[model samples]
Target: MANDGLSAGAAARRLGVAVTTLRTWHQRYGLGPSRHEPGHHRRYTVEDMVRLQVMQRLTAQGVSPAEAAAWARRAPSDASLSGGSPDASGGSPELTAADLAGFPSAAPHPGASGRSGVSSDVAGGSADPVDSVPAARVGDGEGGAPADLAGGAPADLAGATPAGLVGSAPAGGGQTIPLGPRANPAARGLARAAMRLDGPSMRYIIEAAVTGRGVILAWIHVIMPVLIGIGERYEATARFIEVEHLLSRTVTEVLAAVPRPPRDREPRTLLAAADEEQHTLPLEALAAALAEQGVPTRLLGARVPSQALLDAVNRTGPVVVVLWSQLPGSGSIDQLERIQAVPHPPLILAAAGPGWPVEGLPPTVTTLGDLASAVRLIARATSD
Candidate 1:
């Protein structure tokens, strides 16, 4: 047997499937690691990885696991994997098409463990944390999660599949969230993490994106999609509130992890969730994005009663105040009216979040659109 191979966790992340899925594939499909050495656990050879990739793609495309496995088991010996025969539906191919294209062939066999800090030993597989997902990428990728594998696969990170599948039984509710189609791998990975309530993996993927892509890009491409998707899941089933809370808390922590501007500089930007509106993740992203540009802002997180907001406004006398309301009817319009009533009203009173009304607002309040727009507007406003 050739020496290059990956542990179950490393293999799972590479394939973008859960470890249990991997275990199921190994046990039921006979696709387990074929390479074994004197001292270590059975490792997945490059060929083994190729097989798992096939399994993940087929299953993800809605093929029954049993049939997909049968195809996977024969892959090592099948030259048809290169030039695949298409199924009757024409939506999918008979072989793992990803295996035939630049994908499977492009992935280097694990010659020297996968990533910088991970080891490839897995005599007994390591614990999986929410099918540990790699960071989502945000530029010029052209397809679904698996199809985008060539562009977005972080083949080295050691992420194991969570015990439960992503969106399937998230937090053991047995409620499967339809993830729709993911063009962003990070969004796909983040959603999987949220479903598992996998805090560590969620943190890892988010921080990686923020640090590499900057806060705004990360929020728009990576964070918001997952949050919005999860919110929709909650809307449909009224379940996975636990998933939401964990996800929100994890997002808060990661965004907060973004370094703040120097305290010596007085904060001109004021951010707050609207009165009686507790959703503040967007504001958190805004704050972090602003901080990335070295602009300082005072964040008065979560719900702030109208009077309390006025008191803060009066004391700080900020130049810009961004009030966030997630949904309509959850926030009071009186808050904006009171801020307008203040003697030293901010130079720019921005109404952010979807909760704000599009029409009939005091002309003083500017409606902030998306995160990138908010960052640009606020960052520019703060400079002057």
Candidate 2:
């Protein structure tokens, strides 16, 4: 930075974000350059840069822009100017992807141990209070009223269901997706948000989960359960497809919003959905998880016909290709066969998602069982 300070373009480059994004933060959130000289454009001083970095990091982790800005504005000047130590109101230290990777696969239910202190109150209490309460454990056997995860007082879900959803349910019951007793509080909160079709609250909860827990944990513990419950509801009642669509769309947006590796780093990994397969949320989660690990990927969302995928493979020459399938109709072995027979095949061709048949898979193809394993395998292959 010059003594005068850095121009908006320079600051955006240093932050790896768009100039327009910076301008929006300035206009909407009041996070802008403070240094100005006579008859000269305002420039970002080191202190301003530090604030912007804090804003950028928080928002990237899934914090709402307004809340993130509030924290950014409060960042201490003594904090590292190189985007280190946000220290916003004495929050927990940021967890890197490596740090999150060591977390146990089975996260304790929020009620098992009191809710983790990491606050989920980003929605400013506008979202239903029930969502903030910890979920009840399934087999506690001490049958009593449901207790709030935070305060250990009784809580109710009867009123949480929105009026609009009442008619959407079958005659047998009111609007509710049956998340079994074992569901975590985050997952339960997500289910309620989905039922209400509240996009902003849904994004906040999902993003907070991703930021606090890694993408893999967020998907497994928070997202995947809600999706499964919704799918079951749709199967039984043959309704609430709108809820499913909206939730899926929100998850897609959040995962896509996860920051990618810098533009300078060429992506060596490719991800795609099989032909006619519309379910790509898992792949999106995989892509975001990889990005957290500093690996760039080319995500060809939704359905990809065999030739187009091959064309992409040939053009990009990616070292690793992951093909996802969510149903049997889309899982064609010939796609894998064609990719393997390419003039110069990728080092790893992975068959991910439940769509692939357990038998008759090509020996050269790797099958990914879950998000964490997929990240580890592809990240390793790309690094190699």
User: Count of backbone clashes for each model?
Assistant: 6, 1
lDDT at 165 for candidate 1? 14
Q: Which stretches of candidate 1 lie over 4 Å from their true place?
A: 1-182
Q: Local error of candidate 2 at 254, Å?
A: 1.1
TM-score for each of the candidates: 0.59, 0.58
TM-score of candidate 1 against the unseen true structure: 0.59
lDDT of each: 0.55, 0.60
Worst 10 residues of 1 by lDDT: 115-124
lDDT of 2: 0.60
- Can you tell me which runs of candidate 2 are displaced by over 4 Å? 1-174
Measured on C-alpha atoms, candidate 1 has an lDDT of: 0.55
TM-score for candidate 2: 0.58
